[model samples]
Target: MSIPAFADISKSANDLLNKDFYHLSAGTIEVKSNTPNNVAFKVTGKSSHEKATSGAIEGKYADKSLGIKGRVYLLLPTCHPKKGVKLNLTFKQSAFHGRAFFDLLKGPTANVDAVIGHEGFLAGASAGYDVQKAAVTGYSAAVGYIAPQYSAAITATDNLSVFAASYHKVNSQVEAGAKATWNSKSGSAVGLEVASKYRLDPVSFAKAKINDRGVAAVSYNVLLRPGVTLGLGASFDTQKLEQATHKVGASFTFES
Candidate 1:
């Protein structure tokens, strides 16, 4: 669950923060099958860097593996032009929060349940998007074992059968839950950097290179829409080590 980012994506004391919206994915799909047998056509064009990923530490663009890019097994979009129904489904690696120390990596022992969920308009646009989570992720219980399929199949499965309907369970397989929670948390932190990346610049001279190091930082964000947000932020970053270049930054941002 803990995706081992190939490199430290976070800035040290004086790295740079980029303000850019990254294309997590851009793909096209043509329904090969709908309803009944339930199959469809999907084509995806992702970063060709082979090991590239969006929002990596190198900047807010495609960089090396910050962690394994979530696998894109199936991508689908649905909408009712007449009634105004909409849906979005994507499959990618969901990161985990855990660590490897003394040569041992410990984390929530659960495998990333291959996932399939939908969020869309159940009513008018005024109703906004109704999101849903339909996956089988087991957790530990006092009894020692509790399958995601246990106690509450209805809650996890959302009334529809496990492997039926437009929405289906991926059954991606489960790892032990013992450390899954922590690993997932760490991986999720990568998204929090949108808040700030504090950078302090130092005066420099070619004859004598002084402190080249910058500051590094982290922050959390919460929002109902990308167009706007309200969240907490903190950072520690340093100016470009070279001191020859300057980076432009906004503590917060809006499209306008």
Candidate 2:
């Protein structure tokens, strides 16, 4: 990064002058004159923070999962008579496995949820559905809204909640639910999630207690005949939530 060629100074209540994070991106989108009906792909690469090497344990950085992320999105143009704009789908992916041994313990029992941010999450927990026989997992998904530079929301944009789901697999049985998102306020990112899950552990006993709301089970995983990585991060959220509540855990991608 170079010394900024430009600067925007702001005054605080104390009249003290403070400099904000340096300017990195120009907030603009370009549309070609050729194709108007379709949206195309776009990519941006920048350094967020820098550090060197090793292992996965907890959060994003502290455990050694620090590096730049390649971000992606879709672009669309306004038509001759059309009002407003259109956006193609977007997604975020990471290179390591994430872990959370502690239960969200308590929160909405429903199986699906969403939050406004760069990553949408999915999750499910079961106390002891079945040991050596049952496997359970939670699931969630979210799309980061108002990219930081283009939209002021990066600093304070309620990320639009997109979609969510949760599921479990045991023996030969799979139980899952689907969810949708909605936000009444245009400039803000708020959404509702809905879903349900049913489980049967016997590999032959594909049945749920019918009376159970949210499920919990004992889960343990090991991957490296190879490597390890760990990163830790936390944030203070200022979201206006719907009376329907949710739990915030980690985003996950896995392998044997």
Candidate 3:
């Protein structure tokens, strides 16, 4: 198995809890196209009751022989006149990978990350540098072990004030994972969450999760066609069910 990067250590569990859970108050549509020349394009539009309609267009190109890929994004409404564009580039090899990002719209900032893995063991770090202040804004490090059926990782971030650990496992028809975090600066209780996904069939699945806080969520996804999918999700505040503070969302995606 190939180990993932520092931030992706808990991707399996996080994706189950976060991905495809659209907000009921909002609507989104995305279109993706790929070309034979190793280039792709994506356009996304979003609207919500709380905010005005917005959209973004992205273009990407990849060179498999050189192990390099690049992407650029143009945000709708041009958040910043001087820095309205975002850029990213990445290089990947068998044992190492690195990425750089430029988001001038926010602080005119730039950041870089690198990861190295061998025999299912991984180590990596990332740092953000502020251009205006000419100072190191933040940094973190992590290590992880990945296997065919299970994976585990630990990381210290937020200038070493926050620590987190995650573990995931896959079985025949179910995948389960958990993550825990503690903030040394806050001196507060630890936070924990566990999630699981069950495969109903080859084309459909269901997921459910709960956290230390009295909140729980469930989602279902199904492939509607070769290039289309549908997703439905709902979340509830278990501590205040009588308040009717529940959310429901639906999403549809198309690709070609």
Best prediction by lDDT: 3
Candidate 2 lDDT over residue span 1-256, tens digit each: 1111000000110011011111211121112221232322322222222322222222111122543323233223223542333221222234112222222322212222212222322121112112233343333322222221211111111232222211212222333222223443543443322222223332111111111233211111122222221111112122424432322211112211
By TM-score, the best candidate is: 3
lDDT of 3 by residue, 1-256 (tens): 5546557865765676566666453567778899999999998887764667888999999997977777777889675664356777767688887878887777778888888999988889999988888888999888888788888888889887898888889987999888899999998899998888899999999988889997898888899999888877788899999996887766777899
- Order of models, best TM-score first: 3, 1, 2
| Distance from true location, Cα of 117 in model 1, Å | 20
What would the TM-scores of all predictions be? Answer: 0.16, 0.15, 0.86
Give me candidate 3's TM-score against the actual structure. Answer: 0.86
CA RMSD per model (angstroms): 21.6, 25.6, 2.8
Model 1 residue runs over 4 Å out of place are 1-36, 49-192, 195-256
The C-alpha lDDT values of all candidates are: 0.22, 0.22, 0.81
